[model samples]
Target chain A: MVVSVAHLGPPGTYAEAAALAYVNWLNQRGQQGLLCPCPSIAQTLRAAAQGQADVAVVPVENSVEGSVTTTLDTLWQLDKLQIQQAHVLPISHALLSRAETLEEIKTVYSHPQALAQCQGWLERFLPSVQLVPMNATTEALKYLGEDKTAAAIASSRAAQLYHLPILVCPINDYPDNYTRFWVLSLQPSGGGSHTSLAFSVPANVPGALVKPLEVFASRGINLSRIESRPTKRSLGDYLFFTDLEADAREASVQSALKELTAYTETLKIFGSYSIVSIGKL
Target chain B: MVVSVAHLGPPGTYAEAAALAYVNWLNQRGQQGLLCPCPSIAQTLRAAAQGQADVAVVPVENSVEGSVTTTLDTLWQLDKLQIQQAHVLPISHALLSRAETLEEIKTVYSHPQALAQCQGWLERFLPSVQLVPMNATTEALKYLGEDKTAAAIASSRAAQLYHLPILVCPINDYPDNYTRFWVLSLQPSGGGSHTSLAFSVPANVPGALVKPLEVFASRGINLSRIESRPTKRSLGDYLFFTDLEADAREASVQSALKELTAYTETLKIFGSYSIVSIGKL
Candidate 1:
């Protein structure tokens, strides 16, 4: 089967890295055809909605940065695309430059999130230089290749692809920086190891979260992640995106979902698929 | 009293805007003095520890985006600067331009967070334009002044200061977009109306969070916010930062803290201060 993958940039981005990893995983299993790259998460989901792509991959959360709200907001808007799978990729940043020395670098460039993640390191090491920002770290790398006095904070893979030398390695403030990505698709697959879904409940209801959680607890199912996003439509309303460590077919899992639908204002099971490791990508 | 402000820029940034707002608030209260504008949160805390400033203001969380991890991480490290006060500022973004029309705008610039916050609007309005990321929204305005085809996503204040016309007003995706700021001080003030603190519990320990939460619940004190950050030193250890409605001096609040400390392995009161409204600024 063919799949369309949507990431953050043209190429050589962490999102692209994650998407490629998924592509390689599918290819190895002899089950892939096309992987289309999109510029933003909204565009990715739009492509899936229009049937231009079968599936899209987007970053959901970063260990150091918490959550990617763009993806969350887009997911909230799109009703067709369901979260089918997930993968966590370790992120290591590097300061890349065309010039040889820090003295030659007058300006540094990177995505704002990348810059923020490395804020402490940049201040301590490169205090006098000006920081220039770009939409994606890959674009920063591109600018670095063209400008002699500018450096870019990007992944090691980007530096290699762009032929920029690494001025500083692992520039992120946290050593264990990781990004969690979700795979979205229109068709729901069965016989998967787990399922991911997003739902919402009435706000300010003291025990609202507990009742849905009890469904899993009663059946002895494990929950991988649970996050809340404000609906923006109202002050108190919240949409909860959750991941469970079991397929929908499981008796307890089905029972939990059946009970959850009655209580929650809205519940949607995005999709079910096998979980894959980064190394497997 | 002198204050230290930690912001996200070298000189001109939206962080600077927020910092200036805090400085103006203090100055208006007849406490006019120099405010040390540090480039990073860590530096701000370091300044506080070194007794360079009496208080520091840092952005803790944003409504549309969620928590600012750097501020949270730096707070976890310093153990000196405590939350003295909290304020929520409404964020209104403007598209600052040196050129008049969208056709002349070759590149759009802003902080990565600002860009992400306006991703929906940007994608729909400017699909083909290049997005230049900068350290702060203010710096993006600087770029716009220099580049004829560039427009910057910045606050209305920046546009007014730079004499750049606003192409689009309130371009952010959400109307309720606001940022939560914390005024941290070296010493706790006796007349505070609210309290903020940080603590941690072992991961996967069932009801570990609930036990500490019960302390405040039993006292009928409302929690304003609760966020989790991974403790870098340990794999599963998480540091939880919480804000409560009542001041630490309150009898019930004090009793709750005493009870909480007993159940918690690590608990620290960060600060006690009155809540400030956005209108007050």
Candidate 2:
């Protein structure tokens, strides 16, 4: 059986690399999978939701940059899609272009994150060049082949694949850049050993968040991470997303979940997933 | 007293608007203040740090978008500056250009947040147009005036200020979009009614964050907001920035701060500020 994976693409992106890594793990277990690239993270999730792909692997967090809000917001909007597994990838960006000199480059295109990561370098070297945003990092490389004056900030793999000159290597401000990606599927796998979930506290309650969080703390369940998004209804109201070390189906976690509802206005389990730590490439 | 306000600028951006609003408030209090337009938020903060400006007013959060991460990161890095006041301003983005129609807008320029907020509209109408990132939303207006085919997503004020045609009146996806800004000063204001601060919990301590949060909960102090940034020293380690309803000068809040240190490895008080709520314009 083939397990088709979807990710934001044109192939040499970090998202595509993550999908490949997940496919590689599946192959070790005697399963075969191929990647299907989509134009955006929204489209990548849609491919899985629409049954065009078995799962979609998309970056949800960056160590230096914090949460990938697009992926998080998309997952929150499409409530049914569940995280089947999570993966960590070390990231390094390269400046790719066909120009013989930096002076010849008039425009640089990349994902906003990439541009932000290398902003200092751009300011110092090409202060006047235009920085354009593309849907994805590797997708930005497409513009490089068409215009000699256009450059892209993407993975080293993109430079190799696209046959573009490596204008600069390791363009990111931080050498410790790493991103976490989640394998999302339409149907719950119901097997992984960890859980991802989101909840919103009762607005205006003094200890609204603390009560729901206590449910996990009392049970000795440690939380891996927590993120908050404004509720948009008012200034202080928010929706909290968290990842816990315990699975939703576990007896202890199950009881914690039951008590959690008393403090939270909304609770959603994005489902269980084992963490695959492939540290650095 | 001469109040110098620092903000990101080329004149027509929201940050400039924030600085102007702050200056206006100071004027109402029978004081004169001048706006100091900097090239970037980092520079704006630097202007205050070096005493070139009396204070810096920068966006901290948006209603639709979560955090203004650049401002957050800059605040974390420059630990000396303290929040003197907080202000909320309703946001509305407009498409500015010399182009007669959307079809003629071959390139769209904006601050990344503006572009993201208008992503749906851009995708629906000008799917194939190039998106360029500028340092500020107002900074993008510079490109619009120079290139007739270039369009910018900025405040309606930019249209009048730059004499550019308004291609679209309200380009943002959400009409209720608003941004929260903080006035930063070198020393504590001592007058504001509330406080903003950041702390890092010791790694590997189970419920480390819970213990510190409980201090506020036990004191009945309401937290207005909380944001976490990866500590970068290790995995799952994060520095949490939080805004609470009590000031450091208050006896209850002072004791809570003392109790917080027991559960945290590093703590920094970003100082007290009063809340200023200015609803949609």
Best by lDDT: 2
What would the per-residue lDDT of candidate 2 be over residues A225-254, giving only the tens digit for each residue? 888887666556688888888878889998
The candidate 2 chain B region of ten consecutive residues with least summed lDDT is B228-237
Q: Estimate each model's TM-score.
A: 0.86, 0.92
Clashing pairs for model 1 are A133-B133, A133-B134, A134-B133
lDDT of 1 at A252: 79
Listed for every candidate in order, the interface RMSD values in angstroms are 3.8, 1.9
Provide per-model DockQ scores.
0.29, 0.49
Per-residue error at A131 for model 2, in Å? 5.3
Residue pairs clashing in model 2 are: none
How does candidate 1 fare on TM-score?
A: 0.86
- Tens digits of per-residue lDDT, candidate 1, A1-281, equal 66667666767889888888888878898877466767666787788777887778888777766667778777777777766777878888998987877788888888767887888798888888987666678877657656778988999998778777888899898887777788777776655877777787754433555567667756767665566666665333467776677888888788889898876888978777776667422
